[model samples]
Target: MKDILVRSLTGVVFIALIIVGLTWNVWSAIAVMGLFVGLGLAEFYRIFQKENEGPERFTGITGGVLLFSGLCLTWLSWADQRIIWIPAVLGALPFVVMITELFRSKNNPIQNVSLSLFSWFYIVLPLFVLILLRGKANFPFEAIFPIGMLLIVWTNDTFAFLSGKFFGKTPLFPRLSPKKTWEGTVGGLLFSLLAGYLISYFSGLDLTFWLIAALIVAPAAIIGDLFESMMKRSLNIKDSGNILPGHGGILDRFDATFFAAPLFLILHFIYF
Candidate 1:
């Protein structure tokens, strides 16, 4: 009972922060996402450090923040999109890591470099894609896309958990996540579709587009959750961090967003 209360309270606070940040202004959205990227990267590096010994935490974080900031600046129109070369240069960070590793007498330089770069690709890049989604040209104030993305993801996660607890019998992926069930997955999908429709109606977006977005987001969110579960299973850890109390960590909370946001952006570009 106490755990449930703590989880509910934390969830309310988390949603409120995201709503205020995304709705307030472009800078606020960037600030909120910037914090997520930084902390997520930090968490990933910390996990990697447990096994890899030397993951170049400082340089990796610097490159990630640079990449994230560059993307945000360009997407928000605070900087010219042609300054793409800045991120282009920043993308060469892995090679720099390899070279830097040569100077150090580390036993697993390759492992360290690969893991550090993986943090950028896995955590930071998906977040950068989300920032791009917020700046979509059709959306005034750059609001609806990001907000809708969160709505669908959150709705799906909630329904999935509830349905699984009540009617879960057939495991969806017992190897990766034993608690997930096919029934839960379907419940989540239906709820996400409903939430998508509501968002479309309220935001005045096209119904077809929003429904399609739900279709993409629901499965992507499941994959995202399972992927994180796989990572934790491989690392033999329970939660990613202790930041969110009952919720585990930033990665645990936002895993669905990481995959859904990028896929939604892809679909948005292809369709919109």
Candidate 2:
């Protein structure tokens, strides 16, 4: 319990610093996301390492570096068409795997190649969108992009856990996550919608945009939560890492954002 409190508080503080830094300058935000991309890629590769058949040593490190480099290089573009960079990066990852596999033919080449590809798409690519969206200058509600989304996600998680503990009756997906319930899902949706409205009111966002965001984000957040839960269960691990007491790891904490950010970015670009 003490560990949970300490970890939560520390997380809030660190996140607050990142938000402030991001709102202040685009470069600062990119730097922060770049670091996260690196860390997240490392975690993904580490998980793959546990498979024992994958290229655990050199390929894992290479995947991490490539993931980070892709994000960093995308920022150099002046146009918002930066998402186009992803396919190019995706194309290169396989070549990297094949080259490495030829030299080190001791391991299963197919598993090694697949692991490299999966890490890029599953972990790094989604995070790249967060940096791109947050760094956009023309977006009127620029300051709220990262912070508001973070707040909504955190609030949804808190309410879901509390409501589930007290009032849960029906399960949402018992196999994937035994603890998540319909009551929790309802609670999270309500909180997320409320959060969306609050951001609209406080951050000068249009009600239309907020409504759209809420509709889009609430479910994506839930999907993200379940996705990570599946990952944990697959690996037979309780948490992604013990770095944060209640939160688990960087992956656990940011799982919702990984899905939500990309969803929001797509909606923002397409609709607004």
Candidate 3:
């Protein structure tokens, strides 16, 4: 009970900060995202560290900085047409850094390269998406995209847990997540559908778009959750981190959003 209250309070504060920062100014929002990306990457690194195998600390730190820089460049690219150099800047910074890190080490080259590349994809790529969404033209919708993804994912997870506890019959993925069940999944999907409709109605998105998004969001949200569970099972870890009491970590809270947000951003790009 205490855990739930603490997590709920933390979630409220976090959302409040996002809304406040974005409404205040683009830079403020970017700064907030920078902090988010930084902390998120750090937590990911910590997870790797717990396993006794991770990228070189120096290289990882450099990657984190480059990721932040790339995000900033993405922001600048949106603010000006003549300033199209921003994407180029964003691309080159990480590429050069990763390449340099790769060549600097000759031992177990495959593992090192994988770690370097994976960090870029896992840690930095989403931040780049967040920056793009924030700065995209004709998409006042971008701001809502991340928030909507987060909300839907949260709803799915909550309902899935509750439904599974009360009415779970057949396990959905017994090998991966023994606790998940088809009943929970269906209930969660229904909740996500309702969430999508509500967000669309309130946010002025089209009904068809909302329905499509619901279809995409719910399954992806499940995949996101299951993927994290798989990773934890593989690593034999219980939680991603201890930052949020019962919530585990920011990663625990945002696991579904991590996948959902980028996919929703793509949906916005393609359809909205």
lDDT of each: 0.85, 0.75, 0.73
The ten-residue window of minimal lDDT in model 2 covers 134-143
Off by over 4 Å in 3: 50-52, 78-107, 136-142
- Which residue pairs clash within candidate 3? none
Candidate 2's C-alpha lDDT? Answer: 0.75
- How many residue pairs clash (N, CA or C atoms closer than 3 angstroms) in each of the candidate models, in the order given? 0, 0, 0
Return the top candidate by TM-score.
1
The residue ranges of model 1 lying beyond 4 angstroms of the native Cα positions read: 76-85, 136-141
TM-scores for all candidates?
0.92, 0.87, 0.85
Cα lDDT, model 2, residue 25: 66
Please give, for residues 217-268, the per-residue lDDT of candidate 2 as tens digits: 8788889989989988887887776665556777887888888888888887
TM-score of candidate 1 against the unseen true structure: 0.92
Q: Arrange candidates by lDDT, highest first: which order? A: 1, 2, 3
Please, what are the lDDT tens digits per residue for candidate 1 over residues 1-272? 99999999999998888877777776777888889889888888887775447687888888788878876766565456677776677668667878877876778888888887888788888877766777645334577888899899999999999999999999999999999999999999999999999998887888999999999999999999999999999999999998888898899988999889888988899988
